[model samples]
Target: MGALLFRLQQEPAWFVPLAVLGALHVAAVAFRILSHLVLLLRRPTDLCHRYGTWAVVTGPTSGMGRSVALDLARRGLNLVLVGRDPAKLQDISDTISCTYAVQTKTVVVDLALIATPQGDEALRLLRHAVAGLDVGVLVNNAGLAKPCAVYLHEADVEAWVRMISVNLWALTEVTAVVLPGMVERGRGAIVNIGSGTTLTIPSFPLFSIYAASKRYVTQLSRSLHVEYRGKGIDVQCQVPLFVETNMTLGATASRKRRSFLSRLIMPTSDEYARAAVCWIGHGPLCMPNLGHRLEWCICHVVPDWMLDELCLRLNLWHRVRFQRLRTMRASRTNVVNDGCLPCKQV
Candidate 1:
């Protein structure tokens, strides 16, 4: 024991530096994990009172957007439900009003029409919709993705245009319109829905454009958070993995199909939205769900090369599956069409 103590006292000079580095690494990891826990466990702010009486949510007819809108209404805030389909928007508005007893308004416009005359009119209509309201929160939740992952060269130009229009342009424009009012009021929260593809996946090969758009959202939210924090505004980019919605499953998917997928790999949109809203004032960026948070930790520890390889293979498999499903659907459609056709005179 005396000899061991003596040897420790005479340890190599490199030992001190190595020990310090190891200590620092451990401390950093502990701090990170602790902070994440605090954020997750923290009680949510009284958003309806803190921000204002009303919240505006884009794409509120479906998916996460719809869930968030309903959550906000349930929390005693009036809602402006914006979406492309007038009928769907009205239906959701009515539901929220009936269920939550909160005031609800609907805005119908196609965000994918950006840069066109129609797009300009849509923005005009949007501006008019929120003109005199106390719009306290803005959920920049509208986004678009390819029908199926494909090489950039094989993707449709029109689809790419629409994706950019909805994901980037619409978000920017809507934020621009809403932010001024918030700045003047000196209080608000903005939740920008982002995708985990850009954050956790190291290389999103076939979905490059969609990933890039989400990266823009992540950067925009972080920058704006820093820029506006002093002015009583909270900006957060909520990165989500798969959520059970028409966006993840095809729009035509049956209710049972969505339920099964939700059980297997995706959280329901309502579950995700509830978790995301609780994290609004926690930080500039967050993975709100427990499963996604764990996945994020795993992704960070894995080497970049390994992540890249995994992404490539997973996306390639998705591509193959998508193609097979498309082929099968086309075959069934053709069979149905043939059966329906009037018999031609021989």
Candidate 2:
């Protein structure tokens, strides 16, 4: 301080005042940044970025993850992109780097493998990839919807386990690895991408595991926000419904149970991704479409019984299509058995 004053003492009076003011402004910014850094370094758990420089984004292979990565790349931050397929990650990183002209690197570790009892093996690989860099932003977005078409009776246990691993455990493990540095630095952000299923009550009918997984994400995000709000760390939850992606293409047998309503107001993956990045950076939560809130408002005004009946009717209508097809099939069979080709009777 004395050295600074001595140098300033030799300056013109007008120059000295201007220099002092500029120095004060720079000091204020540095202090604010330092304070945030302090809070970030206090702990080492979950997704934290209190004192780091890199943003870690998972599932950069497609859909929301790919979209989110692209948007973040444009934001001028160096990124660590994670995905299962090495080639796919490389392809994505190349496209993003070439197109956005941003610093890019890829780390391919299957989140599913990272969550298992033998997960340490894969985690070791991931740890090696991220060992040198400090990750400040954790984007918890990779998840899977259960594959069920007609009956909830049939559940694929292996797939369910993998889903659980990817949807929840992968998020936690990566967060655990990155959070220590963030807490030590006291300046990070964790953005968990959740689903609107918790509120929409969509007759998505077969995504029991998917909905359950996202509810955990939503709850975890809220709890983290409340717990770490004072720590200069921001935990945000982004819940999107019916995003236009390959998952919701309606081409799959499992997602065929989607009601007309769900398939109607679906937003594009890009829209949801853009809103997610913007909101999670600023607040604890962000809902993309105003129409979803409006629909939610109407749903609240309507009686629960009415909604229930509407859902029930939709299910019945859905089943009736199969029933009518069955009726047609049986009638055709009977006609064939009776050796009557002129006209078929039910």
Candidate 3:
């Protein structure tokens, strides 16, 4: 024992560096765990009164956006529900008004039309809709992914254009419009819905552009949080893994068609929205769901190369499935068209 103690007292040069690194790793892990615990325990801020009575949510017609809009209304905040479809927006607004007894307004705008006269008109409409209200919370929840995973070279030009316009440009423009009011008021919260792709895979092989866009969101939110923290505006980038939304499930499929495995892994849109709202003041960034949090930890520990390979394989499988479905739909359409041609001539 004395001999071992004597040897330990004269530790090797390599051992010291390794020991220091291990200590740092331990400390970082502990700090993260404690911080998360505190966040879990903290009560959510009364968002309606904290900022104002009005909150604006983009993409509120369906999925995570719809869930978030409803949840905000439930918390006593009146809603400015923004979306592309006027009917859907009105429906959501009516539902919120009926269920939560909160005042609701609908702003119909296609945010994908960036930099065009149409886009400007849409922004004008949005501004006009919220002009009189004390807009407090701005949820930049509108985003688009490529229709399916594909190599950059294989991606359609128009699809890439729309993706960039909606995912990045729209977020930027909407924030610019809403932020000044928040700054002037000296209190607000902005939740930018980012994707797990930014946090998990070191490089998303198939969904490269989408991942990059989300990374932009994550970084922008963090920087803005730092810039505006003292001003009482909390900017959070909430990164979610698969939530059972049309974006995750194919657009043509009903939510009822989601598989058990998918339901197990992916939170329902409402579930994700509730957790995201609960973590509002707790972040520059966060993965709100427990399943997603576990996935984030696993991604950090896994070898990058291994993750790359796994993502590639999974994306390839999705591509194959997408192609097969498309082909089947095309075949059915051809059959129907052939049957209708004679009737049209008559």
Cα lDDT, all candidates:
0.84, 0.71, 0.84
lDDT of 1 by residue, 238-266 (tens): 99988778646344355555554444346
Estimate TM-scores for all models.
0.87, 0.69, 0.88
- Candidate 3 colliding pairs: none
lDDT tens per residue, model 2, 1-346 = 9999798888887997787887986676566445434544444233223335578888888999998888877765568888889898898899888887667778767788875556777677767766767667888777776443335566667778888888889888887776666677677888888887666664345456777888888888889888877877788887776677876533344445656665445656676665566555556765555445445545655676776668666545655565676689888888887988655544
Instruction: Give the range of the ten consecutive residues with the poorest summed lDDT in model 3.
Output: 337-346
The list of candidate 3 runs beyond 4 A from truth reads 1-20, 23-27, 247-265, 339-346
**RMSD, every candidate, angstroms:** 4.6, 16.9, 4.1
- Give the 10-residue window scoring lowest on summed lDDT in candidate 2: 42-51
Q: Candidate 3: how large is its RMSD?
A: 4.1
Order of candidates by TM-score, top first? 3, 1, 2
Give the better candidate number (1 or 2) by TM-score: 1
Q: Which portions of model 1 miss their true places by more than 4 Å?
A: 1-23, 249-265, 336-346
